[model samples]
Target: MGAAMAAEAEYGRGERATPENWMYRPANGWTYDQVKELVLPFDWDLVDGNIVVRGMAVWWHNRVRNRLYYQLESARRRPYAVDSEQCIVIDDHNAPKPDVVVFDETGLDIRTVVQIPADKAVLAVEVVSTGSRLEDRFSKPALYAGAGIDYYWRVERDEDDLPVVHEFWLHHEAGRYVPSPEQPTHTGKMTTNVPFPVDIDLHSLIDG
Candidate 1:
């Protein structure tokens, strides 16, 4: 009984497969590669020196990611490429995988890229899900801003379950995210002239 009680110390409900011998910053930072090596079941992200389990993305959620990636891929100016579910490594201690990302391409190649460096990232977009609404709306914006990623967009669902785009840009002076004048909060569709002429039909994200 004592041994069983001792075994469940960290995560009380942990089972045999639960990892042991954890490490984090102030001693040494856990790199993305090391985290991947653990090969945990659920998707994980390194957040503020802790490993966080990301909520499972439902099909509709992923559909938004794919459609956004496609829309941005077609319209973005040169040197920027779009990808879905790619990890943006802000630093050794923080790496959150934004649902969609626009990154400065390394000579127009996505093949060799496995993880994106934050400095090369142009924008980070998160699609709010049932379990991730708070993180997507607040925590991740802070992290992205700190990494100097200039633009951030968060997508939330409307009453009819259509997409709503909320745009923001890093306020370098204040070190936080603020509404982007380039594009205002858009519902059902995103029609914008500034910030590089993005006109995405958000309603079409779902297949009829």
Candidate 2:
């Protein structure tokens, strides 16, 4: 792989339009610092020593994300902040940015900090985009759980084109995510005790 890539870089015979980050290969997975050096766009993640470029979300996908973020951010108070498409560093080998991150202000520096460590995150939410099925369904859950994030929520579009949130928590003993019993497979409204006690009414928010 290394030799092939080196040859490719040397010849420059392929499309010159490829982004610089695509050509990056380190012995270890890309670290937060290394990525910062690349100066790539925000729509990327580091997974198992590979860089995954995230596609742009469709209209409906953005709608779901916006509504969810408003609900979480409005209800929360001091020392906590909500953001979209922010990086969460799990370790050297993995850094997957969930769509919405519920993070606390504890030890956070507003300046010179591009990513948050996993421990700073209270909850991680991923709204399943068409291009992100595998990452949202399998890879992200496992990565977040392994990093010991207390809460993880996955939002999917139902048959009726409404948002359905599935909540999970790290099973500390099992070292994986176990679906929250209190939060069933439902839509329109979400009332749960996650990160903190809160109730959200997503009903009609998707409509005009």
Candidate 3:
């Protein structure tokens, strides 16, 4: 048992540490210090749950990450920060770490996870890594939409295929995130026009 779990030992019965049973039980909230300590020793993810780590998922994530770093070097208007695998507190109720998050240049800084406000994100990207593809596809989209995020990208890689980045824009008319009418062409490039026009070569990221 980790120090964080020991400190929050009051959480009875439902106090499972596995993703299958561990849930965001806000009745006994966890502080960032607690979350950090617990994550240190285990190959686990501390979001709303403690997901046991998967090697393949970690592999795919790194593939995309290498390409993103290359692309960031050439970006026209750089984001305040481009953070991968860092938690952003949307509010008291929610905090999720997307695979790639771009913030406003003005508010970017190296601070605690709680300081990275979800609402300040201009773009949130999630790569299908392990459990709950539905969480990345459906659940997170709704959460980001509600948080008023301008852009959300779902990067999915299937067993025998290349990765695909599905674009969703927050449609002002319906106030929901719907797939863009036209799929981006495969110069392997795509761009976001809402927060800023960030040109990206999608093919390069997926190819790796």
List the candidate 3 regions with Cα displacement exceeding 4 Å.
1-9, 12-56, 76-79, 108-114, 158-160, 181-187, 191-194, 206-208
* lDDT string, candidate 3, 1-208, tens digits: 5644553454433443333223433344543333433433334433443332423457667788656645643563655566676666665435666777777756554553445676678678777766748778787777788778877888776555456678887886676788866553223567655445567866667562
Name every residue pair that clashes in candidate 3: 80-105
lDDT of 2 by residue, 54-90 (tens): 8888988888888778888888877788998888889
TM-score of each: 0.82, 0.86, 0.69
**C-alpha displacement of 63 in model 3, angstroms?**
0.7
Better TM-score candidate (1, 3): 1
Model 1 lDDT-worst window of ten: 9-18
Off by over 4 Å in 2: 1-3, 7-18, 40-42
Model 1, span 8-116: residue lDDT tens: 3533222222356332222244555556445666787788756787888898888888888888878988767787888888876688989888888865456676688
Judged by whole-model lDDT over C-alpha atoms, candidate 2 comes out at 0.78
Q: What's the candidate order when arranged by decreasing TM-score?
A: 2, 1, 3
Model 3 C-alpha lDDT versus the unseen true structure: 0.61
TM-score of 3: 0.69
Of the pair 1 and 3, which is ahead by lDDT? Answer: 1
